[model samples]
Target: MASVPSLSASIQQRVADALGADPLLRRSDRADFQANGVLGLAKRNKANPREVAAQVVEALPTGDDDGLIAAIEVSGPGFLNITVSDAAITRTLAARAADDRLGVPLKADPGTTVVDYAQPNVAKEMHVGHLRSSVIGDAITKILEFEGEKVIRRHHIGDWGTQFGMLVQYLIEHPHELDHEAGETAAGEESMSRLDRVYKASRKLFDADEDFKTRSRKRVVDLQAGDPETLALWQRFVDESKIYFYSVYDKLDIAIRDEDIVGESGYNDMLIETCTLLEESGVAVRSNGALCVFFDDIKGKDGEPVPLIVQKADGGFGYAATDLSAIRNRTADLHADTLLYVVDARQALHFKMVFEAARRIGWLTDEVTVKHLPFGTVLGKDGKPLKTREGVSTKLEDLLDEAVQRAAVVIRAKNEELSEEVVAARAAEVGIGAIKYADLSTSLGRDYVFDLDRMVSLTGDTSVYLQYAYARIRSILRKAGDAKPAAHPELPLAPAERALGLLLDEFGNTLAGVAETYEPHKLASYLYSVASALATFYEQCPVLKADTPETVENRLFLADLTGRTLRQGMTLLGIRTPEQL
Candidate 1:
């Protein structure tokens, strides 16, 4: 089956044809869809509202044969409440079940999209703040790819700066500090520990010893000038940091490729050319011997226009220079139609200035669009930033480990029959799924509390709920054993079945909306609604113990489809649904 038109789409098209304009149809609580266009159309034409509504009802294709709608009633002054045929709902879902992609059509004209996300600073521990970018960006990447759009992932990690000078200089002085003699390749934990020790010692010396500080500053120049030894030591920091980065990413179930790890250093060669081009084009001007782009709306506390400093008077580049260069590369080199930056809300102004500068430079044209999907913070239950008792930023590894540990306890208590090995495996899935779901479920622009108890709860709007809902359906389908799920459109649907079927039919449309808006929360909400609908259906209708054999089979078919749809939606959100969980 080709892509099936939504019931609302079919009705809207029919109503649009009759009205000779858009019908402005929307789903209603009282009916499958309500047409509010009649009142506006009537008031505009100076015609009686009831008469126009009645005329639309007359033109409606609610006939018995080849008709999607079952009833079209003229309600109130000029409103039309429409109910689609029960057969149509089941038929559309059956079409969805038969084909893959959940009946969603790949975009006809997909464009190249370059997504900048999952940024982690080198030689530093990844804190809870990095979670949103990686999880949200991964979901967006999957969703866009599913929509047939060409997507390029950019880690945009921070792997260069003056900090490396301190770290590398200290490592060179203490030759054995970075020695991996224990083994040729050090573990991620060992690498991080070594880096942490070296960084602390180096910082102490730099603060106390003026001579060491001077040498460290000179090492920064040597590193930038491609001094072989200095560059070699700098690479070790990056390499060790990547080892830790990869380990943490693996635990989170997110894939981070080496090639995609384009850090701050990647655009170094382009910085000079980028600044010169901006200066020659007058996009940037020298203010006190420093390149800057000033915005009228952006003013400092001194009532002066705050400029985005591209380069400092000290002959050093800033983040804006690298970002502007990235925009040029993503456009002029990658030929991306859409440039998406999934950064934190705190960096909103930085990106705003950078994008505006890019637009002024003609690097981002009318055909090319750039958007910053700035997300809100993740607060603790205390409504403050999530932190350890020591008042330090919580490490990413500890957070993930604790989630899994808590999930294991929940799993064992819920089902004592499971073996330890099974509990351990399911715990990881449930825990990670819970964490990712909690993040994705909240609207992107709002801050949400991180509560482990609520997240792993078997009840409420948690991933565990969805996971169990799917597991229940899977269990029922398995009990049916040899009997396969086969849709019977001829059979009548119960009210509960009708509700679930209608909601299920909206899955493809819901997914399309999520992909278009770059909002994973919407998809999360949609899955929750489907799960809720399934609960109501399970309560009102019996699958294995229906009144008749055909009734049982039909209900079984519905259960199976619900399971598959739930699995697909969760997978898109980067959550895994275990069959046995």
Candidate 2:
């Protein structure tokens, strides 16, 4: 409704009609566009593929309506090599610019999607794994929301569980352990970070003393049984952990509302009924005193069956049980039409079994789609999982702090006149954007190296590069003050303008593709293309110093439109574009 059908779609429709219902067109690499259905059609009707291709091409209109088709040629094996027209490219861009949503239409049938991500265990340090999950999930949520889907974010923080027992016991002994607020510069310097001190002291006592371990285990039982004293102590641990989590999320520039922090314990009530239903439906069985589901196809390296244990032998519910319960609540209570779990790829098998079990129990049905957007681990330069120099898990706060510092250097170098406060703020956005963009710019299923140098680099597929492109356009538009952007259909477009126009027109289609496939990398790649095209256009066409006033105004309009498109596209990827950087 916003613009005419894309050139690819229009051409496909023409070919489909020519082929009729007998044999349809197919994609071929031999041509820009190909129809391989001729081979199958020939086999069925005793016709040659080349002859069928020729007939289909002839049937395709060679008029103004088919303006996108500069030429339609038949290649070997009956492939249609169609070349699109420059005018068609310019027209689509102009039309897209005229619309409010930039030619991207909302889905007529949108569904409610509940995404569960950013799940960090309480009393434990937030690691790079949690950072990756939060960043990727944020981008996915943005893209889905842009597509008009009702997205409910679930930041399943590990605020509940038995680990709280050890933390609470330790906190009670060291009453002032969890005390802290924002630190001052030179006036206040602490020997240890608040979270570090608490975690270390708790871990030390838990490991060294047998009596402490016994008390911790007992504390867990008490906490589970709703013992008031133990529960109150547990709340302190959860609260302290939240302070640490919020500081990290704040640095990351991600919005994680407190109400969405549904920990595993939130599903405790439903876990019992979930297991009961699973056992009754034969989806799970008691094997070796533990409730589990074994698959014939999934096996260990020793050829033994790999069972998904829903409940431990100690009669305690595990992650599988918690997840199953969450699924039921999401579908029945939350009324979510879709459930998305953006967890690590290492848990793919676990999710696979859980989904199967849920399906068997009728919690997840055809009407409700469930997807596990499992992502790969982030590896260091050594090609192994990222870790600290001492081989410990890298703390997310430390990683983010380093990224922000590095970004400050880049911002200062580019904009020397900026105030310290502005530099810090812009640096945070650029730094966080770089980190997130590094993870999102690649296929989520593949492992990528966490290289700060490459991530914040000024050139090549980085967030800073895109930000610079957007800012540069803004600068040009600002210089051309009072010169409004207006499309001139009668005027012929330059090569750079045509190229930029073609890419801009495909924004809506690209968004739809990214949403349908649950692939943010596609959207990232598309934004990169847009920035690249705009750069080429800027280099070739002068916006503020064109030959004539009208020409300059039209070119400025083009630049303004490009800037808007870039800003919108980058925002969908959860990246911010600084006005001057």
Candidate 3:
């Protein structure tokens, strides 16, 4: 289906035609929309602002049944306060409601985007620090894909490092430590438990036993040198860690394909070539026997230029080399036009240097768009990073489980007659939805408190509130047994009805803004506005109990469209909207 023109766009075009220029129009409390473009248009043409406004209004068609503008008046400073006809709102939304995408248009020119996110180290438990990247990246991916852009997900996991040497060597000596039947995939928790035990035991041995430490260092060389036995042991660690990673992602309600799990190890083969190219191109210089790329703009606290180390003096690769290699693969091999790194705010400098280095080496060209979507920390109520009482990072799985538990309590209190099975099922959706919404609703660079109470509250700006709004609309429709939603263009609308209808028409525009800016919070705010509008509509205009049959149907049409808009918006944010909550 073709994209439906929003009421705002239709009105803007009409006003622009009259003024012969772009109308700087915006939603206003004075009217349905207020045009401020006349002030600028008049100043440029050396005409009285009010006269220009009157001329524009005189040229606009009004008072006709088929006309878009119901009324147009000159307000303060020549502002044109325009009220669109109720029929226009109804007709536009009816068109939107008929389409699956809610009339959102696909991009005319789309390109492939490689999003690098949800990075977790191997054989380690994911913590709250990993939440934003996964949730934000997942939402951005969904939104981009919805916009008809080819999105490629990359989970640049931390599966390669010196620590892996200790892990592999320990596994070699204690082959039975990670004992499971061949081809058996370890459960998430069980895998973490086994890996944690081995890590701790090996650490103790490596720290106290000098010979063990030396042998562990040798194991790293073997692993890097393509020794089959060493590589096999290393693969075990990667495989076991993947099992754990998938389990956690499953609990979070995020899908991560095995093929997308490209970690540091994936770019190992390209590291040497990456460093060689940089060195040969003079983009990197040998500083202190290490191949480094220095940027004059990037300086340390001492005012010395900070250099990005690509390779150490001992010929060992640093993170810069691996990252540069990943850029080369993503651009040269995968042919991506855009690259997004959903990482922590602290890593901003690291990525800045890496990106500049790639550009210097000609791996990242002018045609490619590279962005580091940095996110703030998740904080406690005391304005500090969230941590367990023991001062350890809070585990991701434990936090999600607790959220589900809290959701169950809220769900049971609201609907006590629901079966335990139903409660459990709804609890997962509600709990996970709450976490995701809370993260996405906040600005990317701002920290948010991890409070489940506020998150699950039904009266506030939370997922539960939006979910209940949807469920309430569904309940109303169910009560209308034989009265299906039908658009009545002739029926006059109440203030609340017009408000809801107009907001529903903006759904497509809202999505376009999100896709352009890579910000999910805008979509979240828009959905909240929609839910708020629906709440007012319920208080002012009864859906199933209106005065006339046409009124009831028209109101039902508005409610149904609002429900669909909320559902579609929430889905784009990677959230769920249950029929009952």
Give the per-residue lDDT of model 2 (tens digit) for 188-240: 11312565677787778889999998888888888888889887877766666
Clashing pairs in 3: none
Error of 2 at 263 (Å): 0.7
Scored against the true structure, residue 574 in model 2 reaches a CA lDDT of 85
Per-model TM-score, in order, reads 0.98, 0.90, 0.98
Model 2 spans > 4 angstroms off: 1-4, 14-78, 83-85, 174-176, 179-192, 548-550
Q: Which ten residues in a row have the lowest lDDT in candidate 3?
A: 60-69
> What ranking emerges by lDDT with the best candidate at the front?
3, 1, 2
> Which stretches of model 1 miss by more than 4 angstroms?
63-66, 181-186
The true-versus-predicted C-alpha distance at residue 321 of model 2, in Å, is 1.4
Q: Backbone collision count in every prediction?
A: 0, 1, 0
lDDT of 3 by residue, 125-154 (tens): 899999999999999999999999999999
lDDT for model 1, please: 0.90
- Model 2 — TM-score against the truth? 0.90
- For model 3 the local lDDT of residue 210 reads 95
Model 3 C-alpha RMSD to native = 1.3
